[model samples]
Target: MPVNDTFGDVRITTHRDNDDLLSAGLGLRGLAGTATRFVQPASPTPEELRRRAIQSSWKGIADLGPRGGFGSVYGSIPHVPGREFTSFAYLPGARASHRVLLQVPDEFDHERRCLVVTASSGSRGIYGSIAVAGGWGLPRGCAVAYTDKAGGAGYFDPADRTGVQLDGTRVRAGSAPLEFEPQGLAADAGIAVKHAHSGDNPEADWGRHVLQAARFGLAMLDRAFPHEAPFTAQNTTIIATGLSNGGGAVLRAAGDDKDGMLAAVVAMEPNIHVRGGRSFYDYATEAALWLPAALSARQFDDVPFARVGAASPPAWMLRGAALRAHGRLTSLMPGAQAEEALAMLRAGGWTDEVLATAASSTSLDLWRAVAVAYASAYLKRDAAHMPGGFSYRLQHAAGVAGPIDAIVRAAWWADGSGVPPGTGISLDGGTDLSLDPTLPGVLTLRDLQTGHGADADQLRAAVDATAAELPREGLPILIVHGAQDGLIPVAFSSQPYVKWLRDAGRTPVFWKVPYAQHFDAFLAFADFGDRHAPLLPFGYAALDRAWAHVAQGRALPEDAAVRETRPRGAGPLTAATLSLPPN
Candidate 1:
């Protein structure tokens, strides 16, 4: 089979015996270990990089902690040695390229060929979807395909003249095909991130990238098994699945699958904006503006990461005071102003259940980080051109960045979250030494959302380009989402999309799980684990249902229902903990 015209040179690597495709040779025990270490941190081999990346991505996407029901109940680490094919897919004259990876397990069923196409969740690297899709696909004798969707841990440091190569190695400028290289940058300005600085508005093309990856996966299958010769849609059953942004990407692909390339779609906690639904950036910017002050209320004190009983005024209070001084809040008293802030969020459609887990996002400043990065992408700005002096840099000290370190730069391919504040790199908020650290940057992003100008128009256009429509009629689509997801709340995303599908006379399977929030990885923390159940089990169950419907002709549930889930409070998770519905 000939390689697709859109793909660059394909790179093949074989794994066998001790090494496997799913875990990068790290078995079940290694995956549950405390940390992922490279034998040589300074100069890690390509094999070591792959291992660490697989480990890091698994940790980032799943709940492997003792209380999360990972090893004991649903998850497994199989020894499926196989071949991996990686390539960069790009259209002519495009400056940015999306990474496509196909993993064909040695146990792949030549007779019952199945392909699972996935996109990386959030801004994570190419392996981001491993824990979600690979867990089911590979163990079932199926090949799993993944794409970064033009947003991954590919960071380019203009100052050091280094960028991430397709093989997860660092290369000097112009030495290889870097994932992203901004047109205009200075020697000491900052680092360029693919999701933020690519200038390509990659979100608009996420569906295209997934489709291309699927085609690439089919071609690679033919290349790997010539006796099996041609692998076409007719012989292969294809399922598109993903979580978060990756989930949203698969849904978009299903909508664009007019050629009937996809047999079914299973999206988990997807970041989707249907027609008349509130956009992620719009609500995220709003949350970034109000959450800091709102969480300062006395009620949220017991929530994890909420600053209460601190030596001085907590961070929330300090930021709330700043907001009051800036006239963002009305009441003078801190508690009263906090109440006012909470009321505002409530008025804007945020339920108390969804806001309960917001302390984690607030304490980590995730909302601001996400808003800043997305603002740049929506406006098509690069590192050198970001508003309010916002750019990504390596934080050598508190609230400051120095020269890029060699070791950290080398590991970005494995450790980075395409957005900042991960793998040692952070967003430069351009703070004044005496003021609240993140106020200026937060305000800058909020202004872009609220103000009127060409930039706002441009941002609106970019975001509007990502609005997802219902998939083709009668497609077997299954959507599973956490009812209390703090990040991409169910009300803002899945609920409305389900309604849209119903309004259009389409019936898709939707299972909304209670007590399940986004970021199942957060369940590793003590306080967080005790209160919330891991979303992975339900995701796995959804995959099981989708497979049954596609491969075995099992009927899917017609009406949307709320599945009961029990949180692992003050104990380890057992099978009884998750009351999953029968598939």
Candidate 2:
């Protein structure tokens, strides 16, 4: 037999067998039937109806799992007497503590339907709160989710009207474990040989190390939050997302779990590769100066640097030698010189194979090859280190020693010619950053290009390959780019992506902001700081349009005002400035 329960404008049907409550349904059909009979008959006040709706929505959430046990223990407000439970734990490494509180509503007699709130505190902790608010124009049922300072004080509710406040708390347990490990690689072999070398070792190449770390971390989460029956049932949908490196890991996790365990994935600035693989040796040679002490020690002593160099010398071996010599001769130091060599690698035309060979190549052969390559490429005349007509000053500046210096050289080389320094490009803030989105992709690309770990062309092909795998249904895509992007050339990065979408017949809308760099637009539009400035207005306008297009399934109207660029040297205005007193 089924029993009908009504809360505000929404209604639910529940059944009980002996001491166990069977199920509670909160779909539109169920609510409509109950509303017509009970809610309409009562003709209740708007406030009363709102409260009912709030309660009803909670009832649904509480009853989401099997046996309705999830709701049974935590349902209702003011909670059931003697039915409260609190737990505390610490997060490892983070040195934080976390607390969870559960309370059930009093009006509902069923023990299964309850409200649960968990709070965490720490220097920087992740925490969220959920509440049900009912009444006035509110739907029959509504649930709002919020975070105190979780992801920096933002509201995350399906229902836009509700506001939620979250606070930070530490997890008593130590850091969750998620790491990746390579299998089949020698202890000191570079990743290039790792096609045959994949195994767990601290000396493993960077790619393998990162992969291991990610896997280990995920394992830790699984251990802490074991997939119990109730949890699994309640969590029918799991969304994995993050920013930069974290985002890439989340995407990797999603891709690995095709078993519907992860319902969706969001990756911001996914750093997955689209070109040739890079090697550890290549990376080290390119940015030798900035190479961490640990990495250098491992490269020099443990990894048989000489052998690796002989096997895979970079194209610019001569520059590497000159810089290496300059570092040893001048008080620049080995580490410093290594850093300089890295910068020179970024001027483009350098490939991953060249780097790996240089790292493993013999010193004599390596230097000789480098000298020859330099003469051919830069001097355009074969004259060893002293190419005639090439001034020593120019050579030093462009070569191993000069005004360009180590720091400048390293940054330029690392970014590559395709992504030069000061190339103004900003990432969209709509994607979550907590997950470390950029690193994984960057690391992966580096591995492909330098280590020969993966072919660059194959990696690039993966992008289109993955996109093709998505459901054929039309996807509303939002393309955001800055006209003056310096880090990622707008013409190369964003334009190509947009063209691909159009080719696939997907609806792609492009937004180009003037005078905005990668970091500026990211911070401004993402609402990272005070929201009352010039950025807030334009940011919110763009945000509103994006949300409407993505979440609400609506078309954005063209803004003629947006087309007019501000005149040169014209300072932007903000709401705060507008409210200022007369000078």
Q: Which numbered prediction scores highest in TM-score against the true structure?
A: 1
Give all candidates' CA lDDT scores: 0.83, 0.25
In lDDT terms, how accurate is model 1?
Answer: 0.83
Model 2 regions more than 4 Å off: 1-448, 451-472, 487-492, 521-539, 547-554, 557-563, 567-583
Write down the lDDT that model 2 would get. 0.25
In the range 166-221, model 2's lDDT, one tens digit per residue, is 11111111232101112222322211111111111111121221222222222222
* Deviating ranges (above 4 Å) for candidate 1: 1-5, 92-94, 308-314, 397-404, 558-563
Best-matching candidate per lDDT: 1
- Tell me each candidate's TM-score: 0.96, 0.30
* Cα lDDT, model 1, residue 453: 89
Q: Where is the poorest 10-residue window by lDDT in model 2?
A: 135-144
